[model samples]
Target: MEKSWNNRAWFMVLPVLVLVAFSAVVPLMTVVNYSVQDTFGNNEFFWAGTEWFEELLASDRFWEAMGRNLVFSLVILAIEVPLGIFIALNMPRKGIGVSVCLVLMALPLLVPWNVVGTIWQVFGRVDIGLLGHTLEAIGIDYNYVSDPIDAWITVVLMDVWHWTSLVVLLCYAGLVSIPDAYYQAARIDGASRWAVFRYIQLPKMNRVLLIAVLLRFMDSFMIYTEPFVVTGGGPGNSTTFLSIDLVKMAVGQFDLGPAAAMSLVYFLIILLLSWVFYTVMTNRGVER
Candidate 1:
C-alpha cells in the first residue's frame, strides 16, 4: 500500500542544511579556490594548475611529517583501544563507586586540549617538574625538550591519559546495556570469564569499539595543538606531524599555495583511511 510522502519534512531540514553549507561548504570552497591558484600580492591570483600539489608530493619533508602522523595514530590506537577496554571491564558496574569512577574518567576529558598540553609541558620540564625531577632523582635522563624519544613518549602518554577515558566511557556504556539474561545464560553454561568476554561482551561492544576507533583515529591523525604546545614540532621536527607541518607552511612560512595543497591531500588521506577502517570493521561485524 502506497502512502503519501511528507514533503514538508524538507522544510524542517532546510535550516540545518543552510548551516552546514555556511560552516563546512563555504570553507571547503575557499580551500579549493586557493589550491589551484598562486597569489603574489594585492589579492591577485595566478593559476598554478597543480604545481603546489606536485611539489608537495615530491617533497621529503611532507612525506616525513605524514609518516610521523601515521605512526602516532597507530601507536595511539594500539594502546588506547585495549587499555580502555580493560579499564572499562574493571570499573564498578553499579552503585556509588560507579559514579566516582565515571567522574574520575570524565575529569581528564574535561580538561581543554591546550591546557592538557600546557600541563604536560610543565610536568615534563627538566628543572622543577615532578615527573622530570623524579626521573632525574632516580638517575634517569628525562627531558622532553632535548630528546626526540622523550618527546614522543610524553606526547603519546599524554594523549592516552586524556583520551582513553573516552573509550572507557563508550565501552562502559556498551557493557551496561547488555541484558542480564545473557550473563545468566553464560553462567548456566559454566562459561569462563574469558569465554563470556570473548563470546558475549566483545561481540556486543563491537559497534561501540568501532565508534571509539574511528574517533581516536581521526583525532590522532589531525592532532596539532597538544604536540605543538609541548614540543612545538621539535626536538627538530621529530614530532612534526602533517598538521604541524601544514601550520608551519601556512602561517609560519606564509606559503599558502603549498599549504592549501597539503591540507587538501591531508583531508583526502584521512577520508580514505577512515572509510577503509569502517568498511573492514563493519564487514567483520556483519560476518560475526
Candidate 2:
C-alpha cells in the first residue's frame, strides 16, 4: 500500500523559509557585496575585486588573531572536556543530591554573557573584589589591565567558568541515559572503577562528548562579548581573537572592505573546522 505524503506540510515550512531568507540570506548577500567592493562615504562603491581578501591573507594581524583563537579553543577543549566528564561521573546518580547538582551546574549557564563579564571584571579587581583582595593578601600580583599574561589568564578562566557547565550538563545527560544492563554486566564481570568507565560509560557517552566538544570549540573560537567586556582586546592584543579583530576593523576603524573579507574568511574557517569535527566524531561513534 502506498501512503500519501502530505504536501500541505510544505506550507507550514514556507513562512520559516521566508523568514530565514529575509533575516540571514539577505544580510549574508549584503556582506558578500561589501566584501568584493570598496565603499566611499557618499553611498559610492567601487569594484575592488579580491584585493581586500589578498591583503587580509597577507596581514600579520589576521594571523596573530587566528593563532590566539586557535590556542584559546585548544586550551578550552583540553580543560573542559576532561573536567566535564569527571564532574559528570562523580555527580549523584539519583535522589535529592541529583537535583542539587543539576541546579548548581545550570546556574552558570543561565547568567547572561555581559553579566558574566561584569561579574568577573569586578570579581578580579584588586580593591574590594574577593579574588583580587585575597590574591593581593597572599602576595600574588594579579592585574589583568597591565599584564598580558594576567589578561590571558583572566579571559581563559572566565571562559572556563562560564562554559564548562554546558559540557557537564551534556555529559551528565549522556551518563544518565545509559541502561542499567551495562552497569549490571560490568558488575558481573568484576570490572574495576576505571574498567567500568573505560568499557561501558565512556563508549556510551562518546556521542554526547562529541557534541560538547564541537559546541565548546565553536563558542570559544567565536567568543567576543565576554572577553571584549572583560579585557577589551587587552593590554597588547594578547587576547584578541578573530571576532574581536573583525569588529575592531569594521567598527573601530570603519574599514568595510577588509572587515568583510575577514568576516568571510572567519565564517569559512568555522564551517570547515566544524564539518571536520562532525565527520571525525561521527565516524568514531559509528566505530565504537
Candidate 3:
C-alpha cells in the first residue's frame, strides 16, 4: 500500500515563505531596481542600465576595501580556528567544571555586537582606559585612534575576543559527541596523545570545523559595528571592510545607485565564496 504525505505541513510553511518574501526577497528586488537606475530627487528614477555597476567596478576605493576585507577574514580564520580547537581540546570532558567552562565560553558570544564594540572602544583608550593606561605605563605606544596598525590590531583583537567563543563552543560540541568507543579503541591501541587527536578527534570534528571556518570568515568579512564604533573606518580607512564601505556609500555619501549595485555585487561575492568553501571542504571530507 502507498503511504500518504502530510499535506498540512505545507500550511505550516506558508507563513515562513511569506515572511521571507517580505523580509528578504522584497528588499533584494528593491536593491536590484535601484542598482540599474539613477535618481535626481522627489522619487524620480531614471533608467541608467549598468552605469552604477561599471563605476563601482572601476573604483579604486572599492578594490581597496575588498582587499582589506579579504585580509581581515584570513587573519581571523587563522587565529580563531586553531585557538578554538586548542581550547576545546583542553576543556574538561566529564566533570562539574563542564557547565562552568561552557558558560564562560559562551559569555562573549552573548554580548551585543554594538556593545562589544563600545566596550573595546572605551577599554582601549590611552588616557583613561585600563588597557591604554597599562600600555602607556609599560612605555608602549598604543593608540587605536590615530595609528593605522594599532586600529587594525584593536579591531582584529576585539573580533577574536567576541567571536572565538562561537568557534570554541562548536568545536567542543563536536569533541563531546565522539562516542566513548572511539576513545576506548584508541587507548587499547596505546595511541599517543597526538596520534589520537590526529586520527580520531580531528576527523570527528571536521564537519564542525568547516562550519566554524565558514561562519568566522563571513562574519569577519562583513564586520562593521565594532570597527565603526572604535575607528569609524578612520585611521585612513585602514580597518574599513566591505560592509563599512557599503554603508559609507549608501548613507554617508547618499550614492544610492552605486551603493545598490555594490550591495548586489557584495552579496554575490559572499555567496560565491561560501559555495566554494563548502564544496572544497565537503569534497575533502569525502576523499578522507
Candidate 4:
C-alpha cells in the first residue's frame, strides 16, 4: 500500500517565507530599483541606465577599497581559523572546565557590535586607555588616531578580539562531536599527537572549519561599525574597507545614485566570492 503525504506541514514554513520576503526580498528589490536610477532633490528620479555602474567600475577609489576589504578578510581568516582550532584543541574535553571554557569563549560573541566598537575606541585612547597608556609608558608611539599603520593594527586586533570566539565555539563544537572511538583507535595504533590531529581530528573538524572561515570572511569584508567607531575609516583611509566607503557615499556624501550602484556591485561581489569559497571547500571535503 502506498502512503499519502501530509501537505499541511508546509503551513509551518509559510510564516518564515513571508518574513524573509518582507525582510530580504523587498529591500533587495528597492536597492535594484535605485541602482539603475538617478535622483535630484524633492523625490524626483530619472532613468540613468548604467551610468553609475560605469563610473564605479572606472573609479580607482572603488578598487582600492575592494583591495583593502580583501586583505582584511584574508588576514582575519588566517589568524582566527588557526587560533580558534588551537584553543579548541586545548580545551577540556569534559566536566566543569568544559562549561567554563565554553562560557568564556561565548562572552565576546555576546557583546553587541557597537558596544564592542565603543569599548575598543575608548580602550585604545593614548592618554586615557590602558592599552595606549601602557604603550606610551613603554616609550612606544601608539596613536591609532594619528598613524595609519597603528589604525590598521587597532582595527584588525579589535575585530579578532570580537569575532575569534565565534570561530573557537564552532571548532570546539566540531571537536566535541567526534566520537571517542576515533581517539581509541588512534591510541591503539600508537598514533602520534600530530598524526592524530592530522588524520582524525582535522578531517572531523573540516565542516566546522569551513563554516568558521566563511563566517570570518563575510564579517570581516562587511565590517563597518567597529572600525568606523574606532578609526572612523581613517588615518587617511588606510582602514576604510568597502562597507565604510559605501556608507560614506550613501549617507555622508549623499550621492544616492553612485552609492546605490556601488551597493549593488558590493552585494554581487560578496555573493560571488562566498559562492566560490563554499563550492571550493565543499568539493575539497567531498574529495577527502
Candidate 5:
C-alpha cells in the first residue's frame, strides 16, 4: 500500500509564486518590452530592435563604469577576504567573548544601506565630519566633495566597514565547524600556525570562503546606494559604477529604451560571472 503524499504543500507556495510574479516577473517583462522598443511619451512605442543595445555597447561611459565596477569588486574582495579570515582565525572559539564579538560584528550588517550611506556622507564631510575635520586639523587636505581619490576612498571604506562583518560571520561559521581532531593531529605532528591554516583551516573553510567571495563580489559590483548617497556618482562621475550610470540613463536622462537594454546587459554580466565563480570554486572543491 502506498502512503499519502502532501500535494497540498503546493498550495502553501502558490501565494509566494503569485507575489513573485507580480513583483519580479511582471517588472522584468515590462523592462524586456521597453528594451526592444522606443517611445516619446503619450504611451506611443516603436520597435527599436537591438539599436539601444548597440548604442549602449558603443558608449565609452558604459565601458568606463564597467571598468570601475570590476576594479571595485576586485579591491573589495582582496581586502575583505583576507581580513575576514584573519579575524575569524583569531576569534575566540569558546566563551562569552565569542558572543560579544558576534554582536559587534553583526551590528554593522544590521544598519540599512541608505543609513550606511548617510552615515558615511556625513562622516566624510570636510567641514562637519569628524574624519574630515581630523584630517584637516592634522594639516592634511581632505575633501571628498572636491577630490576623486577621497570620494573613492570614502566609498571603499564605507563598504568595507559595513560588509566585512558578513564575511567574518561566514568565515567564523566555517572555522567553528572544523573538528577538534584535526587540530589535535596537527598539534601532535608539530605543525606551525601557518601549516595549520594552509592545510587544515583553509581547506575546511574553502566552501564558505567561496560563498563569501561570491557574495562580496556581487554586492560590490552592484553597489549603488551608498556611493550614490555619498557622491551622487560625482567628483566628475569618477565613482559612477554601472548601477549609478544606469539610473542616470533611465531616470535622470529618461532614456527608457537604452536604459532597458543596458539593464538587461547588466543582468547578464552578473549572471554569467556568478556562474563562472560558482563553477570554478565547486570544481576546485571536487578536485581537492
Candidate 6:
C-alpha cells in the first residue's frame, strides 16, 4: 500500500528556513564578498582575486596560530574524555547522593565564559589569590603574565576546569540509560570489573562519547572568550590560537580582506576535520 505524503509539512519548515537564510546565509555571503575584494573608505571595492588568500597561506603567523589551536584541541580531548568517563562510572546510580553529585558536576558549566576567565585570571595571580599566594609561599614561582610556559599551563588548566564537567554529564546520561539487566547478566556470568566496563559500559557509552568528542573538538578549536579575557593572546603570543589571531586581524588591525579570507579557510578546516572525525568513528562502530 502506498502512503500519502504530507506536502503541507513544507509550510511548517518555511519559517525556519527563511530565518536561517537571513541569519546565517546572508552574513556568510557578505563574508564571501569581502574575501575576494579589496575595500578602502567610501565603500569602494576593488577586485583582488585571491590575493588575500595567497598572503594568508604564505604567512608564518597564520600557520603557527593554527598549530597552537590543533594542539590545544588534542590536549583537551585527551584529558576530558577519559576523565569524564571515569567520574561518571563512579557516580551513584541512585539515591540522594545522585542529585548532589550531578549538581556539583554542573556548577562549573553554569558560569559564564568571561566570568570563568576572570576567576582564573584573579585566582592565578601570585600576589593575593589563594592559588598563587599558596604556590609562592611553597617556594614555587608562578606567574601567567610574564612566563610563556606558565601562561600556557594556566590557560589549559582553566579550560579543563571549565569544560570537563560537560563531558562528565554527557557520559553520566549515557551510563544511566543502560538497563540493569546488562549489569545483572554480567554479574551472573562472573564478569570482572574490567570485563564489564570494556565490553558493556564502554560500548553503551560510545555514541555519547562520540558526541562529546566532536563538541569538545569544535569548541576548543574555536575558543576565544575565556582565553581572550585571561591572556588577551599575550605572554609573547604563546597562547594566541587561530581565533584570537583572526580577531586581531579583523578588529584590531582592521584588515578585512585578509581576515575574511582567513575566516573562510578557518571554517573549511573545522568542517573538514569534523567530517573526518565523524567518518572514522562511525566506520569503527560499523566494523565492531
- Residue 14 of model 5 has an lDDT of 96
Poorly placed runs, candidate 4 (over 4 Å):
1-21, 284-288
Clashes of each: 0, 0, 0, 0, 0, 0
Candidate 3's C-alpha lDDT? 0.92
Clash pairs, candidate 5, are none
Which clashing pairs does model 6 show? none
lDDT of 2 at 259: 96
lDDT by candidate, in order shown: 0.94, 0.92, 0.92, 0.91, 0.94, 0.93
Off by over 4 Å in 3: 1-17, 281-288
Using TM-score as the yardstick, the better of models 4 and 5 is 5
Residue 107 in candidate 3, Cα distance off native in Å: 0.2
Better of 2 and 5 by lDDT: 5
What ranges in model 2 sit over 4 Å off? 1-14, 285-288
Tell me the TM-score of model 2. Answer: 0.93
- What is candidate 5's TM-score against the reference? 0.92
What 10-residue stretch in candidate 3 is worst by lDDT? 234-243
- RMSD to truth, every model: 2.5, 2.3, 2.6, 2.9, 2.5, 2.5
Clash total of candidate 6: 0
Ranking by lDDT: 1, 5, 6, 3, 2, 4
| Candidate 2 residue 193 C-alpha distance from true site, Å | 1.6
> Which of the two, 3 or 4, has more lDDT?
3
For 156-186, candidate 6 gives per-residue lDDT tens digits of: 9999999999999999998999999999999
Please write out the lDDT profile of model 5 over residues 1-288, one tens digit for every residue.
Answer: 998899897999999999999999999999999999999999999999999999999999999999999999998889999999999999999989999999999999999999999999999888889998899999999899999999999999999999999999999999999999999999999999999999999987888988899999989999999999999998998999999999999999999999999999999999999999989987997898
Q: Which tens-of-lDDT digit does each residue in 87-165 have in candidate 2?
A: 9999999889999999999999999999999999899888978887899999999998888999988998998899999
TM-score of each: 0.91, 0.93, 0.91, 0.90, 0.92, 0.91
